[model samples]
Target chain A: MAGVRAAVVGTGLIGGSLLLRLRDAGLDVTGWDPDPVARGHVRRWGVACPDAVEAAVTGRDAVFLCGPLPTLSGMLARVAAATPEHCVLTDVGSTKAEVAATATASGLGHRFVPGHPMAGADRAGPAAADPGLLVGAAWVLCPGPNGLASFRRLAALLIEVFEARVVPMSAPEHDAAAALSSHVPHLLAGALAGAVQRSTLRDAVLSLAAGSFTDGTRVAGGPPQRTANMLLGNRDRVLSGLASVRAMLDELADALRAADAGTLTDRLAEGRAARATLGERRFDTHQREFPAPADHAGELDYLRALGAAGGHLTGCRTAGGAVTYTGQLPHTPDPA
Target chain B: MAGVRAAVVGTGLIGGSLLLRLRDAGLDVTGWDPDPVARGHVRRWGVACPDAVEAAVTGRDAVFLCGPLPTLSGMLARVAAATPEHCVLTDVGSTKAEVAATATASGLGHRFVPGHPMAGADRAGPAAADPGLLVGAAWVLCPGPNGLASFRRLAALLIEVFEARVVPMSAPEHDAAAALSSHVPHLLAGALAGAVQRSTLRDAVLSLAAGSFTDGTRVAGGPPQRTANMLLGNRDRVLSGLASVRAMLDELADALRAADAGTLTDRLAEGRAARATLGERRFDTHQREFPAPADHAGELDYLRALGAAGGHLTGCRTAGGAVTYTGQLPHTPDPA
Candidate 1:
């Protein structure tokens, strides 16, 4: 790990934090950002700030395209062409299906492992970056056809360097899950805020606002352009998520109007049960090993199944032609 | 206020807190709870624990009927019958319309002022009560046709004793506002939780849950029965709020499918604008006086207007046949 060369393109909060963490982990890391101000911050932190993306990726064993959604596909294409054939590629974008398709179209499918790290702060830029951001966070990796080996390499590095839990799934699986868990929640918050703003009792409503309103609308405080990018970038999945939620709201409205206490209580109880599981998450480790190289397809299937079951890889190592993966089994609470 | 006699019935979190605050303000306060364990807690706090509701409310200047939604009307009837004619009665209930109607039907409209103190915690019962809970909270009082004088007396006492901001509005107004700010948010949280629970990728979704998901669904963690009671009690308003929110979701989904960036950005910006107002609230005092007891209806209209405009009463007093009220005008940010 000490001699492994890793390049980070896009030195914003996520990228800068990864650069710092990779450096601290003793990897030979070089970072590149188009913004001169961001590049200056990298140099100030004593990390190499390559003036060009090509200079950063050349001769590196791994390259991370850590840019915003709109810039990701271009970064992927440029970085993939510049890096050596053996180099593994990954990106820290919120959505995956579109970029994964771009990589496949460019014949870089075998080297590119699509990813999203579930960590951030309200503030942006390298100055606000903290290396501690990635610790114990869930980092999702979507490994496509012929990408299992690359996923293994990147997942292993992330696990060892940042102590991040690696979750493996397909690109579409990641997008749909994110739509339900993250994208739809953002839209819901925005809708709630918009409704309150248009109310005739806006002032009084805001005045009487308590914990519920504040917590529910907290995500709507982010920049509209950024939120719009993430939402629109994952349009199809978000649309489906919105449809599901609207149906839920319709059922709830009916229950309330009909005074169907049974239906209402059942729905609320289900939600409470689900929410209870959130607080009960404990790191109960479970380990599994697969004979790598020889059984690449089998290993990929196993990792996907583990991720689908809510398990995450804590450690991955290739020794004696075998990949020993350490992970935690999902905690299943009793039925509501 | 030293010799004022105040009693709290059906002692729980809200009721117990009120009792402690009243006693702290040098009032002779008595409390009554059906549960002996709660009575023991009141005694431990060195406050009087009357054995029955009749004993608690007898000869009191003001009596607060603090209980659950289902038990409130019954407590109001029992407390009103036992208390002296001059005693001003109020109840700590989340929804006001139904209870206010009950008071009117019981022919205690003049003395009964419906109230809801916008402060609480996840924990319940006397042992979990904190006198500091009422500090800096918005305490809404709905003054019916003949209830202005009673509203003033309670508002003044609350302001002086607990430093609570007093918001005056009609029962319908309070219910409608609460539906948008509190009840509907609870339902949304529940719906989001339910959606995640029902997803095939529930484990992966839960694994990737971040700040937005956690904050948006925090309120769904409350007791389902209590949440159900609130949503059902304010059925019509909750239904209307749900309809409005569902419509917003539909519009958002349409924009996402059609790639209508302008509409999407505008909607998100509107939400961000509305959410921005939540943090910009600051108290700037304004004073007004009305010749009370001479033009009671005029004073009521003024108070209602103040509440509608997001103003809150900080102080109230009667001198020389005039009621002087100190309030804070709403803080309005420049339009987004």
Candidate 2:
């Protein structure tokens, strides 16, 4: 672990932040960015900045592809080809299904773990990068059948070095959950912003906007192109989530129009109860250990189940060839 | 304005904060709450705490009713009966139209100004109040016929003492704009929070709840009963705004389902553009003076027009019986 070498390709906000975190953790980290400006910023930060993604990832124990959704597949393929056989691969893309599929189709699934770090800033680019971005963030890692060992390696770095909670789930599960938690929120924010802008009382609406309006539309202020890519990349799940949200809204509207106070109050109370289950920004961890599965499918199923139940892998160890995975679960059994 | 007497009825968060601000401004202030705990808290702050609303508002130059929506009408009626003739009565209810109607029905419309301060906290009650809550917050005042002088007096207190921007509009106009800016946002937040809670991946979703999820659902964390009351009070406008937002969301879903990147990107960009129009929290003021209207209708129309244009009344002056109203307008003509 002390001699572990890592590389981060595409040194924008997320990647640059990861690169800095890894370097601060005393890992030998090399970084690369297609944008010369990003690469120059990394070099100025006193980190190794290789001119090529291939050069940066060569001989690294772990390689992270931190490109936009549209570029992830190509970047993953190139990184997969250049890195050593023992290298564990992951990406910081918001959506995971497509990337995981691309890796599996290319026969790189065994070593590739599609990941998404649930953290960001309003600003983008390397200049806005800070190592603190990953601290205590939930980093979801979708591990395939043959990628159990790779998941363990990558998750250990995320947990121990970056102080990130490593959530293990399948790519499809990850995508569906993300649609509800992230993508749809972005779309909703945008829609709210757009609706207010188009209102005849647009100026007045903006003037009267309070905490609710500000918080509800804050995500719409993010880079539009990136948000679009995320919603589009996870199109099916986002569509389903959007439809569900729309129906919920329509129901509330009907209740309001009908002056059904009982129904409206119940709906709002349900929401308040649900929001209370979010608990807090950070949670107290209760660790648990499980014997690793005997095969690939067994490993995948076990990890997915644990994550579905809100458990996160901390690390794993092998004693006499019998692997054991250690994870942390919240003390509260049901958030509800 | 020195020695001006002010009374705040139902000293909860908004009322308590106002009572503190009024006292700090060197006004003779009295506060009362039906709840003994709240009245006790106000007394602890070295302010007069009256047992009855009548006694609290007696001889007051300005009286503020800061109770829940259901209690507002009764409180307003009681205060109207108890206060002196020169007293300018106002309420901090979220909805203006209904209360304004109630005041008109009771023949108290001339002295009653329906006002809503666009500031709040997660916690409620007098103990949670902070004098700074009203600082630089938008305080919407729906002024009607015969209330021009009353509006000017109350607005001067808000502008000069509390540092609140006084937005003048009609009751219906205020409600409609608020639906888009505040009420609808609250509904949307609750809906989002509820949807995630009911998701199959509820735990995973909560674990991955980042800034967007947190911000999008923050308002859902407020008191459910109060939020429900606000939404129900402004039911018609909220219905309209919710319908419009539903259509926008459904359209985005259709675009995502069809993989219509062009339409999706365009929609997101529009939202980003719209959100950008929110601009800075505080805007630079450009003061303008207008000759006071000769009639009640003229005054109401002028004030509503100014508020609709995102301008706020600052103060007014009279010389040789010629009244002139001075207001502040943002330097930027169009936020968009």
Candidate 3:
């Protein structure tokens, strides 16, 4: 592993983060970015700043194409034609089918490990990279029969270096799952934000928006082209996810229109249960209910106490001047 | 405000929280709940627990109807018939229009102040109440002409006691805004969660779901009946909001189908800008990028360094076996 020479193309958030992790893992790493500023920045960080993609790819143990989809496809072609037989190629991209097809066409499908790290940020560029970004995140690898051995090696390296969980699956499965987890969520965020922008009291309403609205639309803050590209690239799955969402909404809408409280409550309960299952993986780990004090100052003190207990107050209510609070208790499961 | 003797009918989250806040502010508060357990909890907390709604309402200077839509409507009728003329009534409900109409029909329009607090939790019940739940949150007050003076006094009291921002507006205006800011978002959360639950790789994909998905569906975790009541009660505005969201999705779908990156980019950018504007009110106030170092142990140290600098490592990359990190600096704006 110490002698493993790896190269990263595109020094943006994902690429930059990968490069940093690789360097920290004590790999012989080379970095190439189309942007000279990015290249210079990596150079100053002590990475072997390559002047050309070919220079970074030549004789490398692994070459990770970290650019946009088109850039990665082009680099795959270049590596397939010129890189040494031992230079296992890979990529960190959202979509897999197209990339897999390109790698297969290049006769390097077996050697090309198609991967996607389920981690990102609103910002981009090498300067936004973090070695810890992918830690504890899922790293999906779409492996073809041709490069099964290489994919295994790459997966092992990823686990050891990035401390990421390697989930191996087919390209189609990866795409389908991603549509639900990432692609559709991005579209939903945009649509919700768009509705807000179109509201009659847009500014006033937005001013009143709290944690729910903000959290619901957090992904919409990402770069326009990046979001659009991911959504379009995974079109089929995105459409499928959207259809499911639309159908659910229609059900809720119909229930509301009919004033059918029973049906509405049933559907809402189903959703609430589903959300609770997912809630376990939230930023806060454990949730518990406690007695909240019936006073503003006491409430503040209660919040501080929760924080000191490695938790934070998430909800509060009062009845007859007696207050209660809900908070996430770290490392502790709810007795109920 | 201290001399105010207020009665709360329905000792639930909103009602309970309000009762606690009012009592903490030195008001004489009485609470009544159909559920004996809830009434007992508040009674033990020192609130005068009345056994009957009429008993709680009679002779009180203010009567806050804190219940579901139907309960609130029913209480308004009873209050109109039994409460003293000087008793100013108010309600905490999601939909203002129907509540206002009901109050008007009951001949208590001037006395009833329709309010909607823009704060909530996934859990409900009197046990979930927090005195500080509404602190720093927006509380919309829809006052009829007859209750203008009373509304002003109530607004002042809410501001002082609960530390809530009182936004005075018409009932219709309040409903429309809530549709965009609260109601629609709640429905959207359910729809998204439902979609995830219905996906082919439901469990697997959800396991990979990150902050975006979790945050996006946070509100869907609330009790089903509560969410259904709110959405169904505000049918018209909810429908309008849903229509807006559907149209936006349609546009995005068309662009994605056509592979029209330009249109998709434009829409996404629009969303991004809108989210940026709303982001100012976010609890997280600082975002700065810092340099990360190379090496496993050093990587941890880098994170500590960033933390010490009031920042956290967000991104990292490596070149030539040397690592670099990116992190957000506290109170510093991100420089592109």
Docking band of candidate 2: medium
On residues B34-63, what C-alpha lDDT tens digit does candidate 3 reach at each position? Answer: 999999999988999878888887888888
TM-score computed on alpha carbons, candidate 2: 0.93
- For candidate 1, write residues A108-209 as lDDT tens digits: 999999999987765578887888888778999998868877888898999889888898988888898889888999999989888888788788888888
- Which candidate should be chosen as best, given DockQ against the real structure? 2
What is the C-alpha local distance difference test score of candidate 3? 0.75
Summarize candidate 3's per-residue lDDT along A170-230 as a digit string, tens digits: 6777788788778888888898898787765776567557767787788999888888888
Q: Write the per-residue lDDT of candidate 2 for residues B1-336, one digit (tens) a residue.
A: 677999999898889999898888889999999999999999999999888878898999999889899888988888888888889999999999999999999988779999999988767888789988988898999988877777877887788887777899899999999999999999899888878767777888887889999899988888877888999898888888877777777677777888888888888777787677775534555444444544666667778888998788666564554556677665665676
| C-alpha lDDT of all candidate models, in order | 0.86, 0.84, 0.75
Which sections of candidate 3 miss by over 4 Å?
Answer: A1-5, A21-30, A43-48, A56-60, A79-84, A280-336, B1-7, B21-30, B43-48, B54-61, B79-84, B280-336
Please provide TM-scores computed only on chain A for all of the candidate models, following their numbering.
0.92, 0.93, 0.81
* Model 1 spans with C-alpha error above 4 angstroms: A1-6, A16-30, A36-51, A59-61, A121-130, A292-294, A319-321, A332-336, B1-5, B16-29, B35-48, B122-130, B291-295, B317-323, B333-336
TM-score of 1: 0.90
Provide the TM-score for each candidate, comma-separated: 0.90, 0.93, 0.78
Error of 3 at A184 (Å): 1.5
